[model samples]
Target: MDRDLFRTVKQGTRNQARLLYHRLVCRLPHLLAVTLLLVVAPRLVSTLSLAALWSEARANAAVLLAACAGCAAAAYAYAMSRPRPVYLVDLAGYKPGPAHEATRAQAIRQFGLAGGFDDESMSFQKRMMERSGLGEATHFPASLMSIPVDMCLQTARDESEAVVFGVVDELLAKTGVRAEDIGVVIANSSLYSPTPSFVSLIVNRYRLRHDVVSHNLSGMGCSAGIIAIDLAKHLLQVHPDTYALVVSTENITLNAYLGNNRPMLVTNTLFRVGGAAVLLSNRRQERARAKYQLIHTVRTHRGASDRSYGCVTQEEDDAGHVGVSLSKELMSVAGEALRTNITTLGPLVLPLSEQLRFLATVVLKRVFRADVKPHIPDFTLALDHFCIHAGGRGVLDELERSLKLSAWHMEPSRMTLYRFGNTSSSSLWYELAYCEAKGRIKKGDRVWQIAFGSGFKCNSAVWKALRAVDAVAVGDTGSPWAQDVDVLPVHVPKVVPIDDDEASYKTAAA
Candidate 1:
């Protein structure tokens, strides 16, 4: 054997031995490290006069090991705990009342507002007026009754198409995401359909690629916003990297019931015109610019029975008069829908405290036979912001009470209803904008959005804000409604009525 080769082999063996020793020591217990150091250190130190050096080294090694353990635990904890960013983005809205006024006036007359109907008609009108909170039924002159159902119907059709296009245009302009880039388009209109469905109108208008997917929801009611969001989530999950466009609106023109049917007449008193288009994408690049990320989506349908399903429906009487009627069973049916939604959503976003409270209530009510049961899960624990469906003042009030939310928490929804009436599915976005405009939302804040509609369905979506929206940047094109809002919490004292001013002014001018 060569002398050089033997030296090289010896050096390689020593290197391998050191590597094996290090690997073994790295896995040793904290106490074991101290034990090993104590057992070995005295031999390495070997002070001539110290016979008990090993014991002293062991005591010092234990303290050093404990310090090292604390640092190691902290490093491990920090590496495992890091925050993820959440984003929420709002798209554009389209206005509804662009139809000619003359057509609207004719619709009012043909619909029986100008003293055309008899006793049965008058009776039904009275009932509807009472239900809608429009005070007692009174005849309005032909000129006074203005909202033409026919013109509204026409506008509903054209406006829905316009809303869809406007959304597409906004997405392209704001995100620089072209129509071809949008993989799915989900457009929802509660009523009225033109020759080319609103979805097709958008695709054709933009000359989108032939393969783009499209869905049109004809009569899902206001809850269609979450329905679309859920659909978009599923599409995004399946299509790797994709963008989905969700547009929500209600077609009020054809939806108006002119007959003396009280249920249908309730719609005439409210329901303003509005539409919203939102663009959602699953791509990482797009998510950076996105305002809100879709956190969780839950949907529940109470269509298990005919009664449950037909709570809100169009009916025709024996006299051949058509109208939409509501069953006394509708409120219970809505509650069922809401119950189903909470069941599905509660486990997803609720905090541990809320979950425990909910579980305790269910257990106490069912198992223990307790005299008192706890309330349902604390929804406020799960969400800092809420954009509940603004279907009506009554609907908003019901949700606020059920959820134990504050008046300020429901202000956005109430204001949305006052401003836009009921824009059907698009109403949620309007409500969200109201919250943003008031500077109520903060970055990383969670928002709970819930909507209910005709399917006896309740749908919900949870969103977390990624950034604080600038107060001045927030826009409400219909801020005229805010003029009616009392800015302070306290209500002003009522003033005495005066009748002479209007008549006197007119008389003096004459």
Candidate 2:
């Protein structure tokens, strides 16, 4: 009883101290501002005194007029050069029908029937599926799910076209935007970059304008989605009064590895059928209708280093079967890339107090050569929501620890993973859709979307909600989370921590 009382008292004391410190940090900038004003007010008063400045001002009146005119001209030029704000009008994430769902038991049974994998490889996949944070309802491409599997260029096209059409049709329906009105079209698919690229396919199907600026990004990996968004943002800035359509997906049909190579099998269990289409408009009139406004984007690439470059590579194995190899160094490279990205992003989004703290840490380490640990900025203070890529369970687990995010902040990512597995480049969008479905996004809420992929690139897109995103009706055909999101915030079984050797393998796979 005495020990319990002491523990309670100590916990209360710690909570109070934490609260007090947070309040102080919140007000530090204001305190500093007041101090600065007090210090500078005397000098300003003396300089602006009529007696002191009257003679100087009259003597330099002509010079002052010329300086004012020059300043005005410079301001005008700067304003003209500023980029237009990109508004995310709306987005649609493709929801696969009931026929596409890949239940866990069914997947394992099919894996055994398909053959080629050794007993060890078979067990590896079984274990991975059990702890992969993917639920039974996640969809796989119909072509690949067949007992014998039919993976061909035609099947790949079938999968890609279905995803593209599903999301784009839903997006157009909700936004009431005509395909002809789309001035820019950008499509990204890491693998299966077919002839009539995704951009060309979208343009031809929608009968988009002949002059539409189109870009097809291939082999950019999962991070390519945000990279597409960043590209669209820049295009919208330069090409005023236009709508940009960004399509992100990964076609698993042709990329699935049939060999017994353990490292390559990771992709088979993780990736699934998913895609997302986003509509961005630079038109001033769309601001009222837009769901969110693009605030900032930061991308970090570590591919220059040999280790990072070789971390994720598509190559033929010794047996002559082609697949994307997962190197053990992948997680290490990703961590470095993430660090570089968030460091660049911190100043752009972190609050004044957090910025000052981060700045102090930098100065102490770089300038003063102090031994203090580098401070991890409190990103939660800056961002109201976080949508980290749902690559795998370990990826989400590591990020949750690194960022000190609460379970609530991670729910969307976790739920998305459970529901969709890893949709590669399109996973981040599905996570965002989850937030929208839950109505967790309020006006002025800041959201951070971060993803890393092949080329060892880490990318972030920051968005500010323009208005409260209305919660979705259960089973809305437009959303991937339609069937089960209402039942979500579902209980995901926690993965047991693995040994070092297994951990590295899982990390690289993630």
**Taking the tens digit of each residue's C-alpha lDDT, what string does model 2 give over 1-510?**
335323433443454466568668766756986999899989978768776577777899999999899978976876676678999999999888889987776676566656566667767877888789988788888897786788889989999999999999999998999999999999999988998789989988999999999999999999999999999998987888999999999998888887888789888788889999999999999999999999999888888889988889998877887888889877778877887777667756777688567557666866787887656779998899999999888889989988889999999999988989899989889999999988899999999999989988999999999999888888577676676767889878776322224333333233
Q: Each candidate's TM vs. the true structure?
A: 0.70, 0.82
Report clash pairs, candidate 2.
none
lDDT for 291 in candidate 2 is 94
lDDT score for candidate 1 against the true structure: 0.63
Q: Ten consecutive residues with minimal summed lDDT in candidate 2?
A: 496-505
| RMSD to truth, every model | 17.2, 9.9
lDDT of each: 0.63, 0.84
lDDT of 1 at 336: 65
- Put down candidate 1 lDDT per residue, 1-510, tens digits, no spaces: 134323433443454466557657655555576898999888767753465665766769978788889979976875444222222345765543324222222322334533334555544433433333121111122222353323444555554555566555665676677778878888887666566778888888888789888888777877988888887777666665677878777655455555555555656655545678887777766656677887877788878879888998766755665656667777667776786677666756766677556556555755676766446567876688888887665677678777889877776676665445567788788777666656677888888888988867899999877777644231334322232234422221222122223323233223
